[model samples]
Target: MKIQKSFAQSVGTLYLVPTPIGNLEDMTFRAVKTLQTVDLIASEDTRNTQKLLNHFEVKVPQKSLHEHNYNERIPELLDFLRDGKSIAQVSDAGMPSISDPGHELVVACIEADIPVVALPGATAGMTALIASGLLPQPFYFYGFLQRKKSSQKKELEDLRNQTATLIFYESPHRVKETLKNVAEVFGNREVVICRELTKLYEEYLRGTAEELIEYLSEHSLKGECCLLVSGATEIAEEEVFEGTLKEQVEALISEGQTSKEAIKSVAKRHNLKKQDVYKEYHEL
Candidate 1:
């Protein structure tokens, strides 16, 4: 005997709704509909979201879902979907997944074959990135840096030669130290600093690494900051072949430098990834 599937079964959609970064007016029209219609709403913070829903007069039920509980709650959420109940997932602010906790849950929903829809909404990183006046393409988002100076320094060192724009979000207290580290690691690259975005006191500070270091010292910073730094430019191919690798290698090799030693020196001096230099040495 064949069994018939029930049409009354509910299908849940994980909508990554973005809330206002600062101004409540930034919320989109579709976001309002999705929040109001979903069977359940998931948020990073109930208190914060309550104010939003209250403002829009959305009477939907809500569940707490954030970085700490996202993994723990997904299985249960999936079970709710299998029971055929529609649901909506949202972070406390901005898009649900980016720099937020919903990424893992999104992957879980995909694995479970649940339909997911991300409603268009405000995202601080994107807002700051485009307005940052940096080369938007080929950019990287670091979110937040290691708070410790040494660890943060290492992070900057790793990206020292990254040939794209770099972005990071930081609290007011650490913005000064963070920018200083950028200057030390990447040199005098251009920086666009955004603070209290889309608010009455919104400010954008544009300057070089050296200038920002000076400016921040004198001014009182009031809001969370997003930083954009331009990346290193790729040097022309002709610049490298000008110094014969064999000649360079032979000089180091003659000075008791092993193949590894010779490769490291060349790689560091030329700002090429170490693996590329090793591959060329292996080919030789």
Candidate 2:
């Protein structure tokens, strides 16, 4: 385990800065200052990041670091950091490594004993989650699903038994199709589609998967979308409980539920007090 003191001053650091997802005002003061002070800014798209820099009047020079060039660029960035030159990494929008470039660079930096400081600003997944009208906490942030229908459905099926809220990012053109898969695999569960977040025309579409699929059938959606799906219900959880109370709880635990969650599910299924279920599951 390596401990990183971000501001050690002896060695150069890599700052993971966040940019606004849609509205430019979401950029944080610290993020701008870090960008301005860094020796270099490694951006997923130099052209896209340039507009943000121009707006904030940050004069820092930028280098391209997208998926295509990351393999070749990581070495150069390591060299820059080793030379005691701090750098800031940013994506087109939102946090640097959330469904964007920078994760690999971060790993490289860690392995090389370089300090990496991340500044929180904006993230489309969390932004959409809080307003999704779904359970906010205990959420699973699945960035993007496979483009193919079979693979997407298979992936959804694997997550069907999960009890946490699921978040996904999708292009507008594929939103309707993705919803159709959700409806078929997960049934008519409650789903929310957040579009154009933080922009003037931002919109949220809330309904059952089937309902939104039908709405999009007649309408066209613009802007990138965040799709939130409610997770497995109590009814679905009960379906897997087929044996004794202790055995049932163990089964849920084996399926990745925590001991507390397994006890709660067992209690809910049998209409027993949580204490009673917990006692039985613990063999106390």
Candidate 3:
């Protein structure tokens, strides 16, 4: 009998490798092995990935794969796959497909019948959510919000009635604005704000949306911020308005507004005291 190998038994290889969210311990053993053995690794930046590869002692050749050059880079990465060589994709942090450019290459791999495996590792949103101490029942991952004020407000409006919890990734500078906008569209709903996760001085603050806005307004934030907003309170189908404090507050908080701004909006809408809204929101 002759030894036989079918074409199906041979195939191209692609890998979605996740990097550390913060502490290096978050890296997985499988991720290490795959990066160690892959023919070439496509990283978001050669310098950033080089630091990671240096730390882990992974010496695979890595080139940049980011938004600027994605149009040109995908075909280059795919060529290795077409040649039956394996390639591992990694981001500066977290899973490659998420909020990162590796998804395009992964999609190409899928279209070409390449074997693409995602080795699970760090993801900031899930990490923040798990550590947030807030209810995790059902949540929406909003990713990064739009920078424009009106657009950001619209984003929140779109999720106004979603019963799932809302999660978002925000920059240090933009956290205040995003919270303000969220407060307008979603109203004084509970919010958990996390920042500089897994690093020294990592912070997690939980409070109503207005309270969060007040807090951030006073403090000069210096690191990345992740906002987790509690979902809309259930509304009776017969009821014209969701009409809860959270909903009321959410409706008023806009992108560039402050707690004071949100409070004014709520007070005007409900014919209630600004003091009363502030007191309930802050217990002050």
Which ten-residue region of model 1 has the weakest summed lDDT? Answer: 1-10
Show the lowest summed lDDT stretch of 10 residues, model 3.
1-10
TM-score of each: 0.79, 0.82, 0.79
Q: Candidate 1 lDDT, tens digit per residue, 127-243?
A: 998988889988988888999999999899888878889989888889989999998878888998899989999999998988988998898798888888988875323334445
Better of 2 and 3 by lDDT: 2
CA displacement after TM-score superposition, residue 168 of candidate 3 (Å) = 0.2
Best by TM-score: 2
What does candidate 1 score on TM?
0.79
Model 2 bad stretches (over 4 Å): 235-284
List model 2 lDDT by residue over 70-137, tens digit each: 99999999999999999999999999889998899999999999999989899999999999899998
For candidate 3, lDDT tens digit of each residue in 1-284? 22323224365577789898778887889999889998888888889889888888988898788989988988877777788888888888898877777777777767766777777778989889988877787878878888999878877777888888778988988888888888777778899989888888899999998988898778877777888988878652433456666555666564556778887877766768889888776756
| Per-model RMSD to reference | 6.4, 10.2, 11.5
Give all candidates' CA lDDT scores. 0.83, 0.92, 0.81
Question: Which scores higher on TM-score, 2 or 3?
Answer: 2
* Segments in model 3 whose C-alpha atoms lie over 4 Å from true places: 1-9, 236-284
